[model samples]
Target: MAYSHDSVADIRSESFPDYEARIEDAYIEGYDPASLGAPHSSLHTRKLWFGLGLILAALFGIGLSVWGAAAHIWGTGTQIDLSNRLLVLGLIEVAVTLTLGFVLIASSRKGYKEYRKRTGRVN
Candidate 1:
Protein backbone atom coordinates (compact mmCIF):
# COMPACT_ATOMS: atom_id res chain seq x y z
CA MET A 1 0.00 0.00 0.00
CA ALA A 2 1.16 3.51 -0.74
CA TYR A 3 1.64 6.04 2.02
CA SER A 4 -0.87 8.87 2.26
CA HIS A 5 -0.34 12.10 4.12
CA ASP A 6 -4.07 12.38 4.68
CA SER A 7 -3.87 9.47 7.10
CA VAL A 8 -1.82 11.43 9.59
CA ALA A 9 -3.69 13.97 11.66
CA ASP A 10 -2.64 17.62 11.63
CA ILE A 11 -2.53 17.79 15.42
CA ARG A 12 1.08 18.60 16.20
CA SER A 13 2.99 16.30 18.49
CA GLU A 14 6.51 16.31 19.93
CA SER A 15 8.08 15.16 16.66
CA PHE A 16 5.83 17.17 14.36
CA PRO A 17 8.33 19.87 13.51
CA ASP A 18 11.00 17.42 12.60
CA TYR A 19 8.62 15.40 10.48
CA GLU A 20 7.22 18.49 8.85
CA ALA A 21 10.64 19.75 7.87
CA ARG A 22 11.54 16.45 6.32
CA ILE A 23 8.33 16.29 4.38
CA GLU A 24 8.77 19.85 3.18
CA ASP A 25 12.32 19.11 2.11
CA ALA A 26 11.19 16.14 0.12
CA TYR A 27 8.36 18.10 -1.44
CA ILE A 28 10.86 20.78 -2.49
CA GLU A 29 12.90 18.10 -4.16
CA GLY A 30 9.89 17.12 -6.31
CA TYR A 31 9.15 13.88 -4.47
CA ASP A 32 6.39 12.71 -2.27
CA PRO A 33 7.73 12.54 1.28
CA ALA A 34 4.85 10.48 2.62
CA SER A 35 6.78 7.32 1.82
CA LEU A 36 9.62 8.51 3.98
CA GLY A 37 7.66 7.78 7.12
CA ALA A 38 9.04 9.54 10.21
CA PRO A 39 11.83 12.11 10.47
CA HIS A 40 14.88 10.01 9.77
CA SER A 41 17.80 11.71 8.10
CA SER A 42 20.02 9.55 5.91
CA LEU A 43 22.76 9.72 8.47
CA HIS A 44 20.37 8.60 11.18
CA THR A 45 19.23 5.61 9.12
CA ARG A 46 22.82 4.62 8.32
CA LYS A 47 23.86 4.90 11.94
CA LEU A 48 20.82 2.95 13.13
CA TRP A 49 21.45 0.15 10.63
CA PHE A 50 25.13 0.09 11.55
CA GLY A 51 24.32 -0.13 15.24
CA LEU A 52 21.79 -2.90 14.74
CA GLY A 53 24.16 -4.85 12.53
CA LEU A 54 26.99 -4.42 15.00
CA ILE A 55 24.82 -5.67 17.84
CA LEU A 56 23.65 -8.69 15.84
CA ALA A 57 27.17 -9.55 14.73
CA ALA A 58 28.44 -9.21 18.26
CA LEU A 59 25.72 -11.52 19.55
CA PHE A 60 26.50 -14.16 16.92
CA GLY A 61 30.22 -13.96 17.62
CA ILE A 62 29.68 -14.20 21.36
CA GLY A 63 27.43 -17.23 21.00
CA LEU A 64 29.80 -19.00 18.62
CA SER A 65 32.81 -18.30 20.80
CA VAL A 66 31.06 -19.46 23.96
CA TRP A 67 29.86 -22.62 22.23
CA GLY A 68 33.31 -23.38 20.95
CA ALA A 69 34.85 -22.80 24.38
CA ALA A 70 32.30 -24.99 26.12
CA ALA A 71 32.70 -27.77 23.58
CA HIS A 72 36.42 -27.69 24.12
CA ILE A 73 36.10 -27.75 27.89
CA TRP A 74 33.34 -30.34 28.40
CA GLY A 75 32.65 -32.20 25.21
CA THR A 76 33.41 -35.93 25.47
CA GLY A 77 34.45 -36.25 21.85
CA THR A 78 37.57 -34.13 22.35
CA GLN A 79 40.60 -35.02 24.48
CA ILE A 80 40.11 -33.38 27.87
CA ASP A 81 43.19 -31.63 29.24
CA LEU A 82 42.34 -29.15 31.97
CA SER A 83 45.90 -27.80 32.22
CA ASN A 84 46.47 -27.68 28.52
CA ARG A 85 47.07 -24.41 26.61
CA LEU A 86 43.89 -25.07 24.57
CA LEU A 87 41.83 -24.67 27.72
CA VAL A 88 43.41 -21.32 28.40
CA LEU A 89 42.91 -20.30 24.77
CA GLY A 90 39.26 -21.30 24.85
CA LEU A 91 38.73 -19.33 28.07
CA ILE A 92 40.44 -16.36 26.50
CA GLU A 93 38.16 -16.59 23.48
CA VAL A 94 35.09 -16.50 25.71
CA ALA A 95 36.43 -13.50 27.61
CA VAL A 96 37.34 -11.69 24.41
CA THR A 97 33.92 -12.37 22.91
CA LEU A 98 32.23 -10.96 25.99
CA THR A 99 34.43 -7.90 25.85
CA LEU A 100 33.64 -7.41 22.18
CA GLY A 101 29.90 -7.62 22.87
CA PHE A 102 30.20 -5.03 25.62
CA VAL A 103 32.19 -2.71 23.42
CA LEU A 104 29.67 -3.01 20.58
CA ILE A 105 26.80 -2.19 22.93
CA ALA A 106 28.68 0.80 24.29
CA SER A 107 29.50 2.07 20.82
CA SER A 108 25.87 1.73 19.74
CA ARG A 109 24.74 3.66 22.80
CA LYS A 110 27.29 6.37 22.13
CA GLY A 111 26.12 6.62 18.53
CA TYR A 112 22.52 7.03 19.67
CA LYS A 113 23.55 9.70 22.13
CA GLU A 114 25.38 11.55 19.40
CA TYR A 115 22.31 11.36 17.18
CA ARG A 116 20.09 12.75 19.91
CA LYS A 117 22.58 15.53 20.55
CA ARG A 118 22.65 16.47 16.90
CA THR A 119 18.86 16.49 16.75
CA GLY A 120 18.59 18.60 19.92
CA ARG A 121 16.67 15.83 21.62
CA VAL A 122 19.24 15.14 24.32
CA ASN A 123 16.59 14.18 26.79
Candidate 2:
Protein backbone atom coordinates (compact mmCIF):
# COMPACT_ATOMS: atom_id res chain seq x y z
CA MET A 1 0.00 0.00 0.00
CA ALA A 2 1.21 3.52 -0.85
CA TYR A 3 1.36 6.18 1.82
CA SER A 4 -0.94 9.18 1.28
CA HIS A 5 0.48 12.73 1.01
CA ASP A 6 -0.72 13.61 4.51
CA SER A 7 0.77 10.43 5.93
CA VAL A 8 4.12 11.14 4.29
CA ALA A 9 4.10 14.70 5.54
CA ASP A 10 3.27 13.54 9.04
CA ILE A 11 6.06 10.97 8.97
CA ARG A 12 8.59 13.54 7.70
CA SER A 13 7.60 16.04 10.39
CA GLU A 14 7.77 13.37 13.07
CA SER A 15 11.24 12.22 11.90
CA PHE A 16 12.75 15.69 11.47
CA PRO A 17 11.26 18.23 13.77
CA ASP A 18 13.98 20.92 13.23
CA TYR A 19 14.37 20.55 9.50
CA GLU A 20 13.42 24.17 8.82
CA ALA A 21 15.77 25.45 11.48
CA ARG A 22 18.60 23.28 10.11
CA ILE A 23 18.05 24.60 6.61
CA GLU A 24 18.10 28.17 7.91
CA ASP A 25 21.33 27.50 9.74
CA ALA A 26 22.89 26.05 6.63
CA TYR A 27 21.97 29.16 4.67
CA ILE A 28 23.51 31.36 7.34
CA GLU A 29 26.68 29.24 7.22
CA GLY A 30 27.04 29.87 3.49
CA TYR A 31 27.37 26.22 2.46
CA ASP A 32 25.26 23.18 1.77
CA PRO A 33 24.88 20.58 4.49
CA ALA A 34 25.69 17.85 1.99
CA SER A 35 29.16 19.34 1.44
CA LEU A 36 30.06 19.48 5.11
CA GLY A 37 32.33 16.46 4.90
CA ALA A 38 34.45 17.77 2.04
CA PRO A 39 37.55 19.67 3.08
CA HIS A 40 37.93 23.26 1.84
CA SER A 41 41.67 22.79 1.28
CA SER A 42 40.96 20.23 -1.40
CA LEU A 43 38.68 22.69 -3.16
CA HIS A 44 41.33 25.41 -2.96
CA THR A 45 44.03 23.09 -4.28
CA ARG A 46 41.82 21.99 -7.16
CA LYS A 47 41.16 25.58 -8.11
CA LEU A 48 44.88 26.32 -8.00
CA TRP A 49 45.63 23.37 -10.26
CA PHE A 50 42.88 24.35 -12.68
CA GLY A 51 44.14 27.91 -12.87
CA LEU A 52 47.70 26.77 -13.43
CA GLY A 53 46.64 24.35 -16.13
CA LEU A 54 44.73 27.04 -17.99
CA ILE A 55 47.68 29.41 -17.76
CA LEU A 56 50.01 26.78 -19.14
CA ALA A 57 47.64 25.97 -22.02
CA ALA A 58 47.25 29.63 -22.83
CA LEU A 59 51.00 30.15 -22.82
CA PHE A 60 51.41 27.12 -25.06
CA GLY A 61 48.92 28.53 -27.56
CA ILE A 62 50.69 31.89 -27.57
CA GLY A 63 54.07 30.23 -28.05
CA LEU A 64 52.77 28.12 -30.96
CA SER A 65 51.32 31.20 -32.64
CA VAL A 66 54.58 33.12 -32.22
CA TRP A 67 56.60 30.18 -33.55
CA GLY A 68 54.32 29.83 -36.58
CA ALA A 69 54.53 33.53 -37.32
CA ALA A 70 58.31 33.45 -37.05
CA ALA A 71 58.58 30.35 -39.22
CA HIS A 72 56.31 31.86 -41.89
CA ILE A 73 58.39 35.04 -42.00
CA TRP A 74 61.94 33.61 -41.73
CA GLY A 75 61.92 30.02 -43.00
CA THR A 76 64.21 29.02 -45.96
CA GLY A 77 62.83 29.24 -49.55
CA THR A 78 59.97 31.50 -48.35
CA GLN A 79 59.71 35.16 -49.28
CA ILE A 80 59.32 37.72 -46.43
CA ASP A 81 55.63 38.54 -46.32
CA LEU A 82 54.13 40.84 -43.66
CA SER A 83 50.55 41.14 -44.92
CA ASN A 84 49.08 37.61 -44.88
CA ARG A 85 45.95 35.88 -43.60
CA LEU A 86 48.03 33.49 -41.49
CA LEU A 87 49.67 36.41 -39.64
CA VAL A 88 46.25 37.84 -38.84
CA LEU A 89 45.07 34.47 -37.62
CA GLY A 90 48.12 34.07 -35.41
CA LEU A 91 47.61 37.54 -33.93
CA ILE A 92 43.99 36.71 -33.21
CA GLU A 93 45.02 33.50 -31.50
CA VAL A 94 47.50 35.37 -29.30
CA ALA A 95 44.92 37.97 -28.34
CA VAL A 96 42.36 35.31 -27.47
CA THR A 97 44.85 33.31 -25.40
CA LEU A 98 45.98 36.38 -23.47
CA THR A 99 42.40 37.41 -22.75
CA LEU A 100 41.37 33.95 -21.57
CA GLY A 101 44.48 33.56 -19.40
CA PHE A 102 43.99 36.94 -17.73
CA VAL A 103 40.31 36.29 -17.03
CA LEU A 104 40.96 32.87 -15.53
CA ILE A 105 43.84 34.10 -13.37
CA ALA A 106 41.85 37.04 -12.04
CA SER A 107 38.83 34.93 -11.27
CA SER A 108 40.93 32.31 -9.53
CA ARG A 109 42.62 34.95 -7.42
CA LYS A 110 39.23 36.36 -6.45
CA GLY A 111 37.97 32.90 -5.54
CA TYR A 112 41.06 32.23 -3.42
CA LYS A 113 40.50 35.48 -1.59
CA GLU A 114 36.90 34.57 -0.92
CA TYR A 115 37.91 31.14 0.30
CA ARG A 116 40.46 32.66 2.65
CA LYS A 117 37.89 35.07 4.01
CA ARG A 118 35.34 32.32 4.51
CA THR A 119 37.81 30.11 6.27
CA GLY A 120 39.33 32.92 8.38
CA ARG A 121 42.80 32.10 7.09
CA VAL A 122 45.36 34.89 6.85
CA ASN A 123 48.13 33.07 5.04
The top-ranked prediction according to TM-score is 2
Tens-digit lDDT track of model 2 for 44-106: 454556656656666655665676677676762555554354556666766775667666666
Q: In model 2, what lDDT does residue 47 have? A: 53
Query: Top lDDT: which candidate number?
Result: 2
Cα-based TM-score, every candidate: 0.34, 0.42
CA deviation > 4 Å runs, candidate 1: 1-36, 40-44, 76-123
Report lDDT (CA) for all predictions: 0.52, 0.56
Q: Total clashes, candidate 2?
A: 0
TM-score, prediction 2: 0.42
